[model samples]
Target: MSNPHPLQVERRGSGVPILCLHGHPGSGSAMAVFTEPLSTRYHTLAPDLRGYGQSQVQDPFEMADHIADLEALLDREGIEECLILGWSLGGILAMELALRNPQRYRGLILIGTAARPRGNYPPIPWWEYVNTGIAGLINGVKPGWQWNIDTFGTRSLFRRLLKQHTPTAYHYLAHAGTPAYLRTSRHAHRALNTALRQGYNRLADLPTLTMPCLMVAGADDINITAQSSQETAQTLPRCDWHCFPNTAHLFPWEVPNAMNETIHAWLRQQNL
Candidate 1:
């Protein structure tokens, strides 16, 4: 593959490799909560998928592009065999990668994701988009107010919405306000969802992914319901699933310590 724009990867620690893939509209940095904890024992490689964070995408792209990028990234990194940790959109891509070459991955840590996501995703209020755009414009014009815009402007609104819709996840994102949350390309975001909406169903292929899998879901996640994760887990040959109470789609961040403990225990149990 001729790499047009080489992915920007955040690599940490050293030992067994673990490819960490972040959620939609997120970057490699978003996976820091998971990567940092495991870094002491495992080498974690988190890449900002094309169009997210520093790995900017000029033209509109689809899921295939993302898969290609992951393939190229692994090849370039000399990662012939490794574990995969994927959240939300990353989980979908992880499944695709595993299906494409099941032998490459020894295990999978999937969080807040699904193989065939069903149910209507609640739409973000139109006013939030307008408010965010205004905030972005203000920041663009007066770079000095970047922090103010992030805190008092855009993030303030995000906090309110998350508090109302997902109070548990809100607690983490509200304070952290990670930069990756704002770096995603709108075009890329739209294209990725468009592709998913068009058609994405690999339920039948689940059996092919015979590697040990640890799946975690938020009990209250409407975006991709815990039931969805349960269904996927049932199909997989070796999958240990968990659904955390009082958490939503961003449960990984909401309860990082607990999540890490679960992951570590699962890894030990699988002897990976």
Candidate 2:
């Protein structure tokens, strides 16, 4: 599964490198908030995995393709060893990479992800249709947000409404309409979902990742419950786990400062 294609990376700062991997339906830009602060102290490398963002791929691919891309990416970057930070789908990739060759990574930071996904890929929830229609109606008048028919492909309405009724709602809503998000390939989205549905269980491999690891999850994240992260942490030999209260799957964006502080403190304590 050697991918000759090099992933498009977003690199920043210098010194120890930290490879930041974004979740499904996300590009390297999604990790900017977390990587920006860390870049001051550590070199951060965020890459758009194939079929996502600028690293567009036309042919079909799988999880193994992504893993190979990462391995190739590190070699291309001339990084012998680095810390890996992953969110959601990115976390799964991180674990796979570490499991494949533990020595290549110094440590790991996994956020809002699970080793074993619940695999609940139901058709668009009925409520989403209602919300999208409302959002579209609102957009027509106020021009506050953009509307698209591919609600499943573009989560503009869902992301907007998830933040609840607040001034930030508009800001959150705008995320779906952003060029980066909009540019994400719908084919990439379905590929990952299909992989999950086919059964993604790495619980058995958790104990093999001996590197110092940090696992964080949002309590309110129904997509990947906090309990799943805790279970994965318990199996790991060296893991620091945390469950952020009053947060969902997108907790990093919801509480960026707190998440950043927690990661910084952990890295300091571990002397990483």
- Computed on alpha carbons, the lDDT of every model, listed in order, comes to 0.79, 0.77
lDDT of model number 1: 0.79
Name the runs in model 1 displaced over 4 angstroms.
1-4, 120-178
For every candidate, C-alpha RMSD to the true structure in Å: 4.8, 4.3
lDDT of 1 by residue, 1-272 (tens): 23546999999999999999998768888788889999999999999998998898767776688889998899989999999999988998899999999999999999888898754355677776677656545544544353544554444344332212233343345433346667889867787778867977889989988999998988877778889889999899999989888766767766778989999999989887
Q: Which one wins on TM-score?
A: 2
Q: Summing lDDT over every window of 10 consecutive residues in candidate 2, give the lowest-scoring window.
A: 160-169
Model 2: per-residue Cα lDDT over 33-119, one tens digit each:
778999999999999988888999877777788988999889878899999999988999999999999999999999988788542
TM-score of each: 0.83, 0.86
Residue-level lDDT for 72 in candidate 2: 87
Per-prediction backbone clash count: 0, 0
